[model samples]
Target: MPSTSQIRNDRTAVAAWTLSVSHPLMTLLVALWLLLFANLPFWRTVWQGVEGWDNGNPLFLLSLPLFALCWLYLLLSLLAWGRLTKPVLGAVLLVSAAASYFMHSYGIVIDYSMLTNVLQTDSGEAMELFSGRLVGWLLAVGVLPVLLLSRLQAPRRRWSRELRVKLVSMLLALACLVGIAMSQYQSYASLLRNHREVRLLLTPSNLLAAVHGYVRRELRAPQALQVIGGDAHRIAHVGAAIKPRLTILLVGETARAANFSLNGYARQTNPQLAKAGVISFSHVSSCGTATAVSVPCMFLEVGHDHYDESMARNREGLLDVLQRAGVKVLWRDNNSGCKGACDRVPSEDVSHLNVAALCGDGECHDEVLLSGLQDYLDRLTDDAVVVLHMKGSHGPAYFKRYPAAFARFAPVCRSSELDQCSTEAIVNAYDNSLVYTDHVLAQTVELLKRNGQRFDTAMLYVSDHGESLGEGGIYLHGLPYAMAPEEQTHIPMLLWLSPGMERHANLQAHCLEGLEDRALSHDNLFHSVLGLMAVQTAVYQPERDLFRQCLAPRQAFEGRAGASGAIN
Candidate 1:
């Protein structure tokens, strides 16, 4: 053992050897380190995206890193103060490491929507995202840099001198950035324009921008709730003689259309739904690539093309409109809580229910949405709309979505760390979840059929968004809408109408079957529901309603009771 005096001397030497630098110098070095190591995803994407790179100008390739370094250095200079230097850079490094891992491991980009999804993710879902590989990645890239940063010290200088140095450094970085841009303006412009998502791959910059955007949006002044469809009133087609209509809007999660056998998948993913007399719309697309955006957008009359998140949050949606029209509206969710779409309506999140068979590991399967559903339906005596939001195929733990009995697909991926599993195993796990969803849908139809004597019932199932099961190396969802693949946008949709609903709405099953190939999307959801429920409002565009053309002329129902002013 060394003596106390010797130990003190050794500590003093170690302290003296600690790297010390000016704030500007520290920022520059950190920026360079980040550009090289923290942006592998960015570099990889750029390398692959560059058209004809083998024959392309070498100068263009050189300019890419030069521009990135200058950009990062200039941005780093904003917070490169004496005390804030290490802490800020350390935080950036840690965040960049996490962002880098996700971007590289799963081909996702950090965007406003993705950031929103992350912020809104529940503890159970967040837990599923945690993996050993992620911890290792963070240790290697995030924790190590932060640890190194702790040893380094930025020696304080005169305030005026420090400011001057930082300003000069920023100017130099800006100049280099400008010079690089000028040298390859066309190439840079083409690259950005063609692959707009590339910008969202930049490590710390992407994370910072996304967080900034989210904060700005969230901190903005609250808007007054805009109540729409004030003139809404449900028209009775059969007077008091016929049973009331009960429309169950079954919203599915992460169910891609490509995997749905009803949409022509080779695997029988939707076996139960296939035999349940449902009309599966093969060409249905989703409003957005994630539940946070898609759920609210689908409820808005404006549709995805014109969707404004702020506007949607402050406005009355389809459910509110239905309620205003005297249709009892209730939203029961097994997934995330309706993404605020059901805020104004009667909503229940049954995900945390402690039912023995359906609930375990802090989550209930999609079947839990059906629990106590019959009792609720039995109590309903009026025209009503019930939204059953199923946790259908929500991943990366696809196996957990279904019970073991539903795990008919052999050799399924049992772990949430999806990348560790073979693609075949992942698909098997996902398909099994869909198989469970199928059973749930079939059970819903059976329940509707059982209640047909008292109510004319229908079930319309549409997924909020689709999932990406390792397609193009992209796993999970929430790539920006423009860059999302068919697996992330194309969703499975189907309709099951009871015999009474078929006659009451004057909808022929064969007509709907023929219209299966008709291109539809979440845009049609708002108006189509209005048309089906016989709710008349200015927002109910007959042109957009899928059922409008399929319905017989008003003249056909003219002889019926309460038929006047009913068919809008």
Candidate 2:
């Protein structure tokens, strides 16, 4: 019935439709490859333990899905311009590699040396990055199917039997993707998989459909910032009653509670603190496992499960409450990176300032920050609160950071290459860092004594989280709470009330008589600061305030076994 030219065009149209449908399937498969590599918290470290790739650049939590979408977009955009070919493949890989390399070098840099070490061919860094067993597995598992699919599908194919089979196959592949996404514990509480990520994967028209849902929700939802509970703004500051001129709170980074000599660790890494009469709270626990989650949560009135809820009630934070009540709060950090906790607080990341002569250029010692505090205290009012975020044990290169003075015992490993070093060397290098951390605490106490003439002072110490020193071959922190050992979450804490500050604030009596002995947490730090200043917010509970009162002496370390991995 139709002319010859018309029949020829109709077949072309069907083929285009089949190819268009199959591109999404291709993108989904690649997305699965990237996601599997990154879901583990200690990705490169985990691979290294298996004698796998020495380097693995993790995709940001939202970046892997973006990567997949970009690949699909390239195919569609180029296909729109014309057909696919070898040059197009080359261009796509070039663009993707450029983007990935940039992110690898600068994305939050939990271990900057890990990247440098693995990428250096002379350093075997390149070998580690490329030859990791996981990467090999990915190539074997993912590349073969992809090569076959590319061979079978033509850009201008029709809806033939083979194409229908491909369509069904694509859906099956996507289902597997969904299953993998569902398998991760981080995804258990989230189903949307991030809206931006989903939109990125869809076609432009489909993306608009996805956005409409977002817009509808935005229109219907109430303001998230509105107060749902206690009025942090109206709360009263307890006042300048505590006697000591100032209080220093040292929040240590990654010093595990179990490893401290004060905790009965046979390692004797805590010699300086033991001599200085430091009473380490052997059983202190961290509220969360990661810095981004832990630091903000520690400063809020909300519990971990509802940290976002607290963000609404008060964006003001602990410093705000302290300032309103008239205690000057100053934060100086030489430690692991700061999360948003420092957003509204007066703070410094002195990690780059090599103040401790213990290590060379660019290596910051936590004690160096401690040495500088007396000058900072002198400038502040007598009734002040100073918080030092200490870089106690941020690791991988643990052996190189501390000075030989603190290297108490060792035929220690001298490099970050934990797998190549003996277990004792790994343990020695790590324990020496702990020894130095204790010294830093003692120096802080002596600084308070030197400034004792102006006002009474006290010092309280807490660690953000603990570290994993080669336990199960995972050599650092940030594992999912479910898989983390007690060493990685159990942390040390202490409180030494200066004679004057305690007597002046009437907290001296409170410190000596009001509180009972019991295990405490960084969760208590938020309310305790309020109680110390005497903030009159409804959220202030004595039972929850470590400074005001304690329940009983700390008992055995507690651990929760379920997926939440909450420590009791």
Error of 2 at 526 (Å): 1.3
As for candidate 1, its clashing pairs are: none
Cand. 2 TM to true fold: 0.62
Query: What lDDT score goes with residue 142 in model 2?
Result: 40
Candidate 1 accuracy as TM-score: 0.96
lDDT of 2 by residue, 1-568 (tens): 9999999999888656443334444444443433343223223322333234331323223434443344444333333222343234333333333223322222211222222222221322222223344344444444443444454343555547545655564455456445545554353233233322222222222223434544564355454432222333222212345343477888777788877887789878877677765556666677665554566667766655566523522365666656555567777866544454555557776666645464345556776676556667768753577888866776656765577778887788765445557878878888888888888888888887887777776778888878776665556665445455787678888767666655444444444432323666777888777655444455666677765543122210110112133111
Tell me, by TM-score, which candidate is best.
Answer: 1
lDDT of 1 at 326: 85
lDDT, candidate 1, at 448: 90
